[model samples]
Target: MQKPVIRPRRLRQSVAMRNQVRELNVHPNELVLPVFVREGISEAQEISSLPGIYQHTLDSIRGVVNEAAKAGVGGIMLFGVPAERDAVGSGATDPDGILNRALRVVAEEAGDAITVQADLCLDEFTDHGHCGVLDSRGRVDNDATLERYTEMAVVQAESGAQIIGMSGMMDGQIAAARDALDDAGHDDAVLLAYSAKYASAFYGPFREAVDSQLQGDRRTYQMDPANRREGILEARLDIEEGADIVMVKPAMSYLDVLADVSAESQVPVWAYQVSGEYAMIQAAALNGWIDRERAIAESIVSIRRAGADAVLTYFATEYAQALRAF
Candidate 1:
C-alpha cells in the first residue's frame, strides 16, 4: 500500500483524541425527562409498552422529580393521565386537576433545580381522545380548540409550570397561548411549541403511557411526515407567533427537519426522541441485538449533532447519570 501522509484517522486513534475533536456532546442539562402522572393511583405503575418507564402517582412523581433534579436533567415534561374525561376536557383547566396538581408537586419537589414543564393539550383529558373539541359535525373545531388551549396555558402557568409545551398541533396555538399567559400575568412562562409535529405511527407506545382515549388519528391537524419543507414553515410561523422555543418531534427519524428548524430558527430548537424511538432501542438492546449503552449514547449524540439545542427523551435521567459518571 502507498503511504498516506495526511491520514485523518490520527484524531480517532485514541478516546481522548476523539473527545477533544468531537463536534457535539450530550450534557446532563440538555436532556429533558418526559414523565406521566396518573390520577387515582397510590403507587407508580410501569407502562408495559414502554419498558422501564412508569405512570406515577402524585406522591411517586415527586420522587422522579427529585431524581431528575439530582441527575442534573434540564427539565421534566409532565403528562397527566386523568381518571375522568369529558367532551371539552374540563379537567385540563381545573385548578385541582391531575396535571395541574402534578405540576405543583413537581415544581415544589424540583424547586429551582430543574425547569418544570407541562403538556398543554386536551388529548389526555378528553373522553373522545382528540386534541380539541368536536363540533356539530364531529370534526375538531380549530377556533374552539384555541380557546381551550388558552385556558390550558393560564392554568398550567398558575400551577407553577415554567415551560408550557403546546403539543396539540392546533393552528394559531402559539399566539393564543402567548396572549393568554400574558393576560393571566404569567408573562415569564416559556412557550415550547411542537411546531413541526407529524402525524406519525411512532407514537404507538405513547398511547399506552398516557392511557390515551384517541380512537382515530390526528392526521387532519398534524403535519404529514412526507412534507419536509412544511416543517420549516411551521417552525417559522411559530417563531413569529411568539414561541420561545420550537421543536421537531420524533427526533431520530426527523433529523433533517430538526436541522432545518435549527438553521432557520433564531430561538432555541429542540427535538423529541419520542416513545417509539426509546422503545425500539430498548427492545433491540434487551434482545441482545445491540449494545444498549452505546446505542443510547449514539442516539442522543446524533440528535444533538443534528442541531437540537435540547432533547426530550425517556432516557433523560439514566443518561444524565451515566454522563455524570464520566
Candidate 2:
C-alpha cells in the first residue's frame, strides 16, 4: 500500500525487456551430451524409455558423435556396455574394452571439434555391478576400487578421452586417478570429478544404458541426499585432490548442492540432468501434458540460474540445437 514504490513489474511488461534482463543463459558449449556405446552389436538399438536415444555400436557411434558436434554440443560423455560382464569388470581397462573402444571411436569422429569424456567407473565392468572389488561380506572394497579407477583413468585418457569422468564416488578416487594419469605421462588429461553424486533412483535408466549388473545399492560410496554439508565437503575434497572440474549429479533435484558448490568452487561446477529427469519430462510431453521444448529449456535454464557453469544432460544435442534457433 506504500504507493507500489518498487514497481518491479515494469521490467516484466515486455518480451524484449525480459530477454535483455535474462541473467543465466545456457550456451551450446556449456552442454555435455551423455552417450551409451555397446559392444557386440552391429547397429543402434533404440532405448524404450529414452525415446530418440540409442545404444550405439561402434560403426553407428561415429555418426551420432558427428551429429552431436554439428549440432554445437560442447562434448560427449561416453558410457560402455560390454557384451559380457565379469567378476572384476576386467574389460574396463583392457585397451580394447567396450568403453575405451567407444572413447577412441568418438574421439576420432569428433577430431578436436568436441571434448570426449569417458566414465571412469567400473560398474559396467564387474559382474557384481559394484564399482570396485567386493569384500568377503559383499560390501564394496573402497581402496581396491581406487586402484581400479586409477588404472581406468589412464586407459581412458590414452584412448583419446579429453576428460575422465571419475564417477566411482570412492573416497580417494580423484587423487588416485590424477596420480595415475600424471605418472603415465598423461599430465594434460583432465579429471571431471563426480563430486556430489548421490545415490538416487534417477540412475535407473543409466544402468540399462551401461548394462550394469549391480547386485546391490551403492549407499556405501555415493553420498546420502540427507547430508547437504557433505556436498560442499565432497566438492572441496575433489578440488583439492586435483580435479579440474567438479559435478553435482541429477541437477534439478540437487539445486541446493549445485548452488553451494558453484558459489564455493574455484573450478568449473557442472551438474547432470540425469536419466530419470529426462524420462519424466518425456512422459509428460507424450501424454500431452507439457510442451517438450519449452519444458526442456526451463529445466536447463533453472540449472544455469542456480549457478552451474555447465550441465551434463542426455538432452544436450536436442537442447543445443534448440538454443541456436532461439
Candidate 3:
C-alpha cells in the first residue's frame, strides 16, 4: 500500500494532541441544571424513570441549587409541581404558588453564583394538563394563554427569577412576557423562548417526572418533528418577538434543527437534553450496554458541537463536576 500524503490519523495519535486541536469544548459554565420542586413534600424524592433525578421539597431544593452552584454550572432551571390545579392554572400566576416560591428559594440559594430560571408554562399547574387554558370548545386558547403568561412573567420576576423560560409555545408569548416584565418595572428579567420545541415521543419520561395530567398530545402547539426548516422560522419569530435566547428541545434527536437555529439566530441558542434522552442512557448503562459516564459526556458534547451555546440537562451538575475534576 502506498503511503498517504494526508494522514489524519497523526492528529488522533495522542489524547493530548486531540484535546489541543479540539474544535468544540463543553464547559461547566455552559450547563444549566433543570430541577423539579414539588409542593407538600417533606424530603427529596427520586424520579423512578429518570435515575439520579428527583422531585424535591422547597427545603431540599436549596441543597441541590447550592450544589449546582458549587459545581460551577451556569444556571438552574426550576419546574414546580404544585399541590393544587385549577382551570386557569392559577397556581402558575399566584405570587405564593409553588413555582414562584421555589423561584425565590432558588434565587436565594444561587445568589450571584448562578442564574435562576423558571419555567413559565402552565402544564404542571393546570388540571387539564395543557400548556394553556382551554376555551369553551376544549382547545388551547392562545390569546388567553398569553395573558396568563404575562401574569406569570411579572410574578416570576418578583420571585427573583433572572430568566423566564417561555416553554408553552403559545403565539406571541415572548412579546407578551417582555411587555409584562417592562410594564411591571422588571426590565432586567431575561426571556428564554422554547422556540423550536417539537411534539416528540421522547417527552414520555417528562410526563412522568411532572406527574402530567395530559390526556392527549400537544401537536396543536409544539412543532412537528418532520419539519426542519420550520424550526429556523420559529426561532427567527421568537428573536423578532424579543426573546433574549432561543432553544431547541430534545437536543440529541434534533441536532439538525439546533444547528439551523444556531446559524440563523442573532441571539444565543440553547438545547434541552430532555428526560427521555437521559433515561435511555441510564437504562443502557444499567444494562451494561454502554459506558455510562462516557455516553453522558459524549451526548452533551455533541449538542455543543451542533451549535448550542448552552445546554439544559439533568446531567448538568454531574457533567460539570466531571469537567472540573478533569
Stretches of candidate 2 exceeding 4 Å from the true structure: 1-3
Residue-wise lDDT of candidate 2 within 279-320, one digit each (tens)?
Answer: 899999999999999999999999999978888988998999
Question: RMSD of candidate 3 to the true fold?
Answer: 0.7
Candidate 3 colliding pairs: none
Q: Against the true structure, what is each candidate's TM-score? A: 0.99, 0.97, 0.99
Displacement of residue 309 (Cα, Å) in model 2 is 0.7
The C-alpha local distance difference test score for the whole of candidate 1 amounts to 0.95
Q: How far is each candidate from the true structure, as Cα RMSD in Å?
A: 0.8, 1.2, 0.7
TM-score, predicted candidate 3 vs. hidden true structure: 0.99
Best by lDDT: 1
Q: Which regions of candidate 3 deviate over 4 angstroms?
A: none
Judged by whole-model lDDT over C-alpha atoms, candidate 2 comes out at 0.89
